[model samples]
Target: MQTIQALNQGAEAVDGEGEARVGDGTKVWLHWRATAVRNSEGKIDYFIAMFEDTAARHDVEVAAEANLELMQRLSALKTEFLQSVSHEFKTALIGIQGFSEFMRDADQLDLNDARAFASDIHRDAERLDRMVTEMIALDHIESTRANLRLSAVDINAVIEHEVAVTKISAASAIVTNLELKLPKVSGDEDKLSEVVRTLLADAVKYSPDGGRITVSTSVADGTVTVSVKDQGVAARADFDNRLFGRDELYASNPIRKVVGTGLGLGIVRQVIEMHGGRLWVDRVDGEGSEFHFTLQAVDASLVTPGGGRVA
Candidate 1:
């Protein structure tokens, strides 16, 4: 009302500009404009008032704000990731240096004692090598996504092989309940195998004291889904309802004690996506977490009557 009165008194007023929801529950941002008209005698005559719908502009502003927030989060996570990587590298180097020094001062030690030192050195070197190799693999996955090798590969066979490998040194008891007749999926076999390996390894890593790890496969609505469940500690609060960022896996809480670059699941996710599939944490904050992913199942028509590939 004051704005209207101001316009009537020969003064123009353009106020009350913001957003609101109308009776139909649609949101709109309004930009109010008011102008006072004058007669020949310079006396105020009438007023013109206008409202412009600025909803689209307001939406753009909202989107920009969200983008800024996300960029900020990514920046912070990157710093954390670099720090974690540094710590891992330093630990490996320290082990190598310490064991070498011990060998230099143990000239009189027995042959068995000398072999133990060599083993320690080899173990540390392997740890460092694995770290560098994984970092390279992540870069390759990100840049060469379009070059993925496509073929009809058996997902069950991939699961079986990965489970056997993980059980070799896994403290946890690994088990599989695979559907043998499940359809093959079209994807890069090596990359798909890495996905399975990473998930199983992650399960064992989180359950250091040994627990049950189950790998399963199922089909529904033309999608082949695989799940890896572990009986480990529940995920931290940050990962309960959201996916972990690259550095989030190294969060200074419970996971800080767990050894990883925190990029394992992240890499797994991108690979699944490259195969036109999606991966997610199906269950968390429970007895343990279950990681599930889907891939396009090979069409039934593509297989011969004898359950063999048409080719």
Candidate 2:
């Protein structure tokens, strides 16, 4: 139709580009050009049209655009990761340095005051260690170099131990609602323990004013789910997907109030995945957050009246 119109209007040439499906049902980019061939009387005549397949060039252009976008995303992630690491390190270092300096130069430090300062320093040091450990653990898992001592792990025992340890340091009250006679899971005890610990610590850290943290475990369809619910500042709806992502250390909302390297949750996700499980978080009644993860439940009958799995 355009070719006929161009010819009737005496236009010298008409050109356009569009996408078309080929005989193989594959879409391809095409460019067409139509030229008017006039008669000796300088009147209307037939038009000649030529079509060129531009799929190859189009593919190259699209690939280049995708690569550019990927590079930009990677650059942004690097910047954010560095900023998060620097902030966490600086905060811990400041606490350690201030407490050490105060203890060193104090004219008459009482026994209780000295002990408190030392405890503060130790806590800061431990935080620094934990941050470093999480980074390394994530790296190892990503590299597939992590050696997991997989076994029939008692999930309740891991949760109970982590909750108890967290209660000692957490200002919030930690409660557990573990199911009895729960089936064991095939996972590394140490790694599972770290997962629980990370979740509990996050709960305590976010619940700055000391709220109740409930840790619960349940089983369904050969999967055991553990949830850590915290009555703290709820995460934004948009930030839910990025919560376990290593690239996003903190959200640009109320969740950023708590200081963290953001490596803990990422590591938890990796560990859970390595154990053939999944992890996720949800808003608790629009006022708090509940982090949950699932592990493959082992059959109860596979055990020989003991905690170990039978071959």
Candidate 3:
């Protein structure tokens, strides 16, 4: 009423309290202005009013705000990942540098002592090399657009070969409980081998000097499951709580001081998922933890239309 009276008094006024009809006949918050025109006798003429709808613009602003918040979160995650990687790299370099210095200044040492220094230097160099290689592999696994090759693989053979070839055992015993008649599964052998190697390496590193590590396999319900159990500091609950959540970025925890790049399990998880499998942790009362993963077994139903079994 005040706006109408202002127009009647030969003045312009704005009415921004009401809503306007949209293209879909829905009402939205609106802004309007009225300008009164005068005739030659100075009497008020008809009024011209304009309205602007603000809902669409408001929606756009909201979406942009949400996207900005998401970007900020991603930036923070990138910073954290970089910091973790840098720390791991520096730790590896320290080992190499310290051992190299020891090997360089062993002039007065006995032959066995000099050989030991050389061995330590070589071990440190190997450690650094492993970290770099694993880092590259993690980057590839995370970003690669290529699809995994589906081939019939002997899981038992892959496990045996990986266990036999790995020399990282600091444990007193490694017990293998492999199923002799394990069925073939569709997977990439190399990636699966890496998974086995990563699990075994972790077990060896975490287990006490005389603790036992056990590798086992079983098949049921068209799935083959493999587990690596380590008798070390038990963190199964901690691991399970974060396995599918935010714990992926945590490089180390208070449970152990073992040296690692912290990307091995991440890569293992990626590879297992790529093969249409799942990985998990199982807590043992006094036997530490067991890491398990499952792969679909090759069944006769996977036979193609051409009567060829899926390989």
**For residues 1-311, what per-residue lDDT tens digits would candidate 2 score against the true structure?**
86678667777888988899989999889998988888898876667889999888887787667555544544454455567778878989999999999988999999999999998898889878877875666556555523579888888877777776777777888877776768888899987898898888888777646578888888888888999888876765675666354223234435334345676676677678667688888875546889899999877832222222111
lDDT at residue 235 of model 1 (Cα atoms): 60
Model 2 per-residue lDDT at 97? 94
How large an RMSD does model 2 have? 11.2
**Which TM-score value belongs to model 1?**
0.59
TM-score of each: 0.59, 0.56, 0.56
Off by more than 4 A, model 2: 1-80, 86-131, 143-146, 243-257, 301-311
Candidate 3, which segments miss by more than 4 Å at Cα? 1-80, 90-128, 143-145, 167-171, 241-257, 300-311
Give the count of colliding residue pairs in each prediction.
0, 0, 2
User: Rank order by lDDT, top first?
Assistant: 2, 1, 3
**Cα error, candidate 1, residue 104 (Å):** 5.1
Q: Estimate, for each residue in 97-126, the C-alpha lDDT of model 1 and write its tens digit.
A: 998998888768888978988888888787
Q: Model 3: per-residue lDDT, tens digit, 1-311? A: 78877777666554654556778998797667877777888777677878777777766776667555544533443445557668767766786777677767757667897777677667666767766786677567645414567788888777766776654434447767877667788898877888898898877766777777778888898999999888876564566734232233223534444454555676677678667688898777667778899999985433212211111
lDDT, candidate 3, equals 0.68
Candidate that beats the other on TM-score, 1 or 2, i.e. the better one: 1
Which residue pairs show collisions in model 1? none
